[model samples]
Target: MKDFIKVMKALSDPNRVKVIKMLQQREMCVCEMQEALGIAQPTVSKHLKILEDAGLVQSRKEGLWVNYRLSGGGSPYAASLLGNLKHWIETDPEIIALREYIPGLQRELVRKKQASPAETQKKDSSAAQDAATERRETHD
Candidate 1:
C-alpha cells in the first residue's frame, strides 16, 4: 500500500507523467529533459527526485551528468505500474498525438546544442551594435 501510494504521488503531476512518457522511448539526461519540457533545470530536478524516490525511475551518474529512465528491475509495484501505464498510453489518442512532437523536441535540443560558439558570439555582437545605434540616434 505504501509503495502504491508513493507511485501514485509521483505520477500525480502532469509534468512528471509527461517526463515518464518521454522516457518510455529512451533514456535521457537532465539537460535533454529540460530542453524537451522547456522548463527550468531546478523544476526538472524536483520532478525527477519524486519519481526516483518512488522507485519508478532510476538514474546513473556518468562523470558530470546523470541519465534517467524507467526502472525495469526495481520494485515489483513500480514495474507493474509502468507496464500498465505504457499499455494505457498506447491506447490513448491524446498520448498518441505526442508522437508528432517528440521528434521535433529532440531535434530542437540537438540543434541548439550543436550551434557553434562563433554563431552565438556573432549574434551577441549584432545585438550590441543595434543597441549602440539606437542610443546614438536617441542622443542626436
Candidate 2:
C-alpha cells in the first residue's frame, strides 16, 4: 500500500505523467526532456527523482549523460502500472502534440544545446537584429 501510494503521488503531477509518456517512446536525458517539456533542467531532474523513487522509471549512466527510461521489471506494481500507462490517455491532445516532437528529439542535440546555450542565444539574437535592421532599411 505504501508503494502504491508513492507511485500514485508521483503520477499525480501532469509534468511527471508527461515524463513517463515521453520515456515510453525512448530513453531520454534530462536535457532532452527539458527541451521537450520546455522546462528547466532542475525541474526535469526533480520529476525524474520522484519517478525513480516510485519505481516507475530508472536511470543509467551513459558517458556524461544519465538516460532515463521506463522501468521494466522492478516492483510488480510499478511494472503493471507502466504497462497500463502505455495505452492510457495517449489520445489526449497534449500527448499527441508531444508525440509529434519526440521523433526529432535526440540526445546529441540536447547535449549540443547545453554545451553552448549562451552562444546559441547570442547567434539567435544577432540574426533577429539583422533581420529587423533589414526591415527598417526597406521601410525607410
Candidate 3:
C-alpha cells in the first residue's frame, strides 16, 4: 500500500506524468525536458527527483549531462504501474502533442539553447543581419 501510494503521488502532477510519457519514447536530459515542456530547469529537476524517488524513473550520468528514462526494473509495483501507464494515456491530446514534439527534441539542441545568454544574443543578432541582407537583395 505504501508503494502504491508513493507511485500515485509521484504521478499526481501533470508535468510529471508528461515526463513519464516523454521518457517512454526516449531518454532525455534536463535541458531537453526544460525546452520540451517550456519549464524552468529547477522545476524539471524537481519533477525528475520525485519520479526517481518513487522508483518510476532512473538516471545515468553521460558526459556532462544526466539522462533520465523510465525504470525497467524496480519495485514490482512501480514496474507494473509504469507498464500500464504506457497504454493508459495514449489518447490524451496533451500526450499526443508531446509525442509529436519528442522526435525533434535533441539533447544537443537543448544544450546550445542553454548556452550563455551573450552567445545566444550574438547568434540572434547574426541571424537578423542575414535576414536583412536577404531582404535587401530581394528588393534590388
Q: Which candidate achieves the best TM-score against the true structure?
A: 3
Q: What does candidate 2's lDDT look like per residue over 1-140, in tens digits?
A: 88888888998999999999999999998998999999988999999999999999999998887889998836787888899999999899989999999999877877777777788888899999999999999999
Ranking of all candidate structures by their lDDT, best first: 3, 2, 1
Give model 2's TM-score versus the native structure: 0.79
Q: Which candidate achieves the best lDDT against the true structure? A: 3
Please provide, for model 3 over 13-131, each residue's C-alpha lDDT reduced to its tens digit, 9 standing for 90 to 100: 99999999999999999998899899999999999999999999999999888999999846788899899998998999999999999899888877886899999999999999999
Query: Any residue pairs clashing in model 1, and if so which?
Result: none
Clashes of each: 0, 0, 0
Q: Report, for every candidate in turn, its global Cα lDDT versus the true structure.
A: 0.81, 0.90, 0.92
The regions of model 1 sitting more than 4 angstroms off are 91-94, 104-140
Residue 74, candidate 1: Cα error in Å is: 2.9
For TM-score, candidate 1 versus 2, the one ahead is: 2
Model 2: lDDT to the true structure: 0.90
Q: Model 2 segments beyond 4 Å from truth?
A: 115-140
Show the lowest summed lDDT stretch of 10 residues, model 2.
108-117
